[model samples]
Target: MDRIDTSVAHPARRYNYWLGGKDNFAADRASADAIAAAWPSAPVAARENRRFLGRAVRFLAAEAGVRQFLDIGTGLPTAGNTHEVAQAIAPSARVVYVDNDPMVMVHARALLTSAPEGATAYLEADLRDPGHILAHPDLRATLDLTRPVGLMLVAVLHFVHGEGAALPIVRQLLDALPPGSYLVASNATKDFLPPQIAAVYDRMLTAGQTDIWPRTRSEFGALFDGLDLVEPGVVAAHEWRPDEPDPSLTPADVSVYAAAGRVP
Candidate 1:
């Protein structure tokens, strides 16, 4: 393990703060509060993203019959993590969580314990290096590349700002899995939101503490190329087959778009 620096405000730590977790530091809280002040729905959006993870994991395990998961950008572990949701439905599920954040790595090791029937492993890797993730010794030990693994990208890709963005990185990851593997992802979107909100968000992320890119629905959908999209296509994170009535949920409440697709 490594010593975590509490000096800078990291995206994952700040996200943990937004989700009401105590693993974050004062710097994280301050940045989160500042962002929340600019976009009041941020906290709610973080919660919805977590809910979406639960719902999607359940569907993938119980209905889609997926038993392997490779969750990239796994933030600081909190309640209802990917393995917990998947293995709850199917105890034999195997999950490999990847993240580059040192703070998240520390917390994940402490909090993300696997069930007896299932297995869990963590990789200190970056999403930018999908090759490293695919070749990680721990990942190879825990997951079977021949099987249908569920690939979870979640709200992590936008940090890859640029014209090409993280699309190539995504392709590299998706290319490794065997056929029938699933690609599940969510990304922040500027669609259906005020330009002012988007502008503020852009400025906040550009402060060099975090990476931010707001894509249109089509751009987000393009990430699933050569895969079969499940029902409802790419839509609002909360609307992508919500489980509970979450009266607090609204389309605009979350700026993220989520979807699941199966590789042909």
Candidate 2:
């Protein structure tokens, strides 16, 4: 494990803070608070993003019949994690979590637990390096590449700081999976945010605490170019198969776009 840096705020730690978790440093809390103060819906959007993860995993495990999952950019182990949700539906499910953060690696044990009949593993790898992630021994040991896999990109890709950097990575990972595989994603976007909220988020990037590149709806939709999108396609995170109605959460309040696509 690498040394944990408490001096700067990491994206995972700041996200944990926003989700009301205790495993974060002072710098993380400060950055999270600053974002929340500027965008009052930050915490709500975080929770909604988590909820989207749960719903998508459930659909994949139950309906899509995907037993193997590659959950990239998995942050701190929280409620309704990928393995927990999938294995709960199919006890024999296998899940591999990938993240480069050293702090996340330290907490990998929590995400490693699986049902007795199932398997789970964690890989400390960056998403940008798709080749490294695909070649990891733990990934190879846990999931069968020949079989269909649910490749989960969740709330991670927006961290890539270039215009065309994210989509190629998405394609690279998807290209590795079989035809029946699925891509589950939830990405942050500035399409529905106030101009001031965007400015404040930009300031955080300038501070070098953490960085994100929120995309437009069309840019996000382009990620699933060849795959067949699931019903209620490419909408706000909260609007994708909601379990119940929440009048409090409007489209603008859910600043993240979510979708699930199947490889034909």
Candidate 3:
């Protein structure tokens, strides 16, 4: 709790604000408002990304027969969290959430509840250090590394700046999992945004309040290299097996790319 810095805007908190959550501070709201002004569809894109998460988790648990999940960069707990979605399909499913935010850690209890047959755990770890997450006692105890696990990196990878930093971390995490494990990821992209809107976003990023690097479609797809992508391939978040396809949502409206891939 003491580690939480309410003075500056944080990614998770800003995301929460975008999602209409009440857990964020004034700094987060201000940043979110600024971004929304630049991109009117920002809030809608956030909701669509969350819906994509639910669909992916359901597919992994019900169709792929996966029983374990490791969700990194998990933001503040919301309505249909990974555990809830997975356990709804298989009550015995186990999920481990990873996030480095102290505020998220403060609200970890909300994410810890699990069905009697299933298990859930939260780890205070950063995405940059895969070793610490893999070796964490709580993660080891909650999930069986030998079995298939769902590695979820939804709406989180854009934070790691630099040209080649994000992919290696992704590969390292994927390598640690067994052959049958899966990788589910969604990242923000500038491919669909108009030049003026993209420039506004870039200007916000340049302020250094929080780092965000929106990738191109090809760059986002490269994160799933060597893994078999699920049907429909990589698409905009709202377009990925949507439960209820919104006629209004277009590529330009949803600026995030999402996909699920299997290790084998």
Candidate 4:
């Protein structure tokens, strides 16, 4: 508890609040409200991103036959986690969850639950340091690098602000995996926002009032270079093989971009 800072608003806590979860503080709520003030459908986008995650996991476990998952930036425990989604299809599935948040480390017990035939492990690590995350003993113990693995970087990369920062980290992680592995990634984008709203977002971003770093479609697509993108190359969060139509939302509402690609 000493390491946890309640005065600051962290991305995971704010996301949990957006998802209508209770593991957040006043600061998180404030941050969420600030974002929502700019984009009124912020909560809808969060839920849509979660749904995209579930669909991507299902595609990997069921269609792609991936039995191992390395889910980075695994936020607060939700209904359909990587192991749960994969293990449902393959009981022998294994998962290694990595996150830098101390609160996530504290709630890792909820993430460690595994099917009797499967396994799950959690480690406190940052996405920016893929080397540490990949070389961590806990990660090595849970996942077999020799086999095809599903690398999940869902709804987390927007924090890596700058023109050419995130791609290098992504490339490094993908390089460590075998040829048959798959990469599932998504990031918040402002391409769908109207020019006026985008200007407001830009002002907030420049003033350091918001932490999310919105990227263009080309920037998001660059992360998948040297890999084979699955169907629907890159689309809005709710548009990627959606289980059902979300009539209440539109492309602008869910400004997050999502895609799944295979490492060749």
Candidate 5:
């Protein structure tokens, strides 16, 4: 595996730090701490994002009867990955995780293990190149585009800059999948955060790690134009149908949004 740079804080590493993992370097810890200081609920929001992933995966696997998943921009593996949650419900679920980050690719095999009945593979590709992902050997080997597949965009779409062009890329990926498929996602948002928090995050993005272009509820909803939104609509990650009534899991004030949609 290639040595990861510790000089600059990365979004994945900072998120790992927020989740109380030891995979982050000093730079990541420092940046996470600074953000946490400004937005005290930042760590909670991170945890909520993870929880939302778990909820969305389980819902798709159990309720929606989805067994194939294509998770794009999968960050550092934590507890309850897509395959882990999905396979727990249906042991035959197949998952293909895609990410351009070298560290994420390395960790995908090392940490995101699959159940014996199910299969998990990783694709070293970027979200900007949907064709590359579709043509990836690992993806083609694992996922069948003719079947109902779960397209997971998680917390990575915020890295896409400009008029949120990632939406069209998402459309291309979804266009290939069969009917009854789903798009599970969560992107960062500044609509609810304080000005200082947004300012610091903007600086962090300008530093060259990742970009965060937060949108309003309607703007976020625009990504799923042709898809049917699941219950509760686009809302905070914590507000997306909690399994248990979590009082501490109130709507996050941090700049993060999450939702899941199904293809009709």
Candidate 6:
């Protein structure tokens, strides 16, 4: 547990706190509360993002017929993990989950159970080093690069600060997968937020109070430039083929855009 720092606020733990999970430290709770103090709808967006992940996985397994998945930036396991959602539809699906957090590894081993027919492998890796993630032994053992893969970058790209940093990383990972592969990505956006609220987020980001680097619609669209977008492309998180349609959630409620796209 030397790697697990209870005093710091990790994104996964902070997200878990936002989703009302009990696997968070006081630091995470404080960070979450800090965000919520300015943005009262933070939890709504968190729940919507989680729900979007499930819908994306189901689409990949049930409709796209993808049997392999590389879910990078996998936060602390809660309900409807990538493997669970995919394997439920395709019993023989194979998944390789990647995350940078050491604490996530501990919680994942206990919560992320796999189907007997399907297999799941966890790796400690960072999204910034897509090369290492794609070449990892555990990933190599779990996924077949020759076949199609579902590359899940959900709720993770925002951590990669600075302009044009995430695009190359995304492209590199996508290049490794076959033609039939798919990409499911979601990132927080300030497009829908009114100027006053957006300024609050901006000020927080500048003050080092928030780690998430919100992206513009054009910037996010650039991430999927070479791929063919799925239906209802690039909509709000809760708007992306929700399992149970929630009319109450407007674009401002879930300031995150979610979409799935095919490799070729």
lDDT of each: 0.86, 0.88, 0.89, 0.91, 0.83, 0.90
How well is each residue in 89-151 modelled by candidate 2, as lDDT tens digits? 999999999988888977977546899999998888999999999998989999999999999
Residue 59 displacement (Å), model 3: 0.4
TM-score quality measure for candidate 3? 0.96
Give stretches of model 4 more than 4 Å off: none
Ranking by TM-score: 6, 4, 3, 2, 1, 5
**lDDT for each residue of candidate 3 in 134-200, tens digit (9 for 90 to 100):** 9999999999999999999998898888766789999999989999899999888889999998888
Query: How do the residues 129-185 of candidate 4 rate in per-residue lDDT, one tens digit apiece?
Result: 999999999889989999999999998999899977899999999989998899999
Give the RMSD in angstroms, all C-alphas superposed, for model 6. Answer: 0.9
Tell me the lDDT of candidate 4. 0.91
TM-score, predicted candidate 2 vs. hidden true structure: 0.95
| TM-score-superior candidate, 1 or 5 | 1
Clashes of each: 0, 0, 0, 0, 1, 0
Q: Listing every candidate in turn, what is its Cα RMSD in Å to the true structure after a full C-alpha superposition?
A: 1.7, 1.5, 1.2, 1.0, 2.1, 0.9
**Which regions of candidate 2 deviate over 4 angstroms?**
203-210
Candidate 1: Cα lDDT at 50: 85
Q: On residues 155-219, what C-alpha lDDT tens digit does candidate 5 reach at each position? A: 88876776657778888888888899999988777678667766776776667534446667776
lDDT of 3: 0.89
Alpha-carbon deviation at 263 in model 4, angstroms? 0.9
Show model 3 residue runs off by greater than 4 Å: none
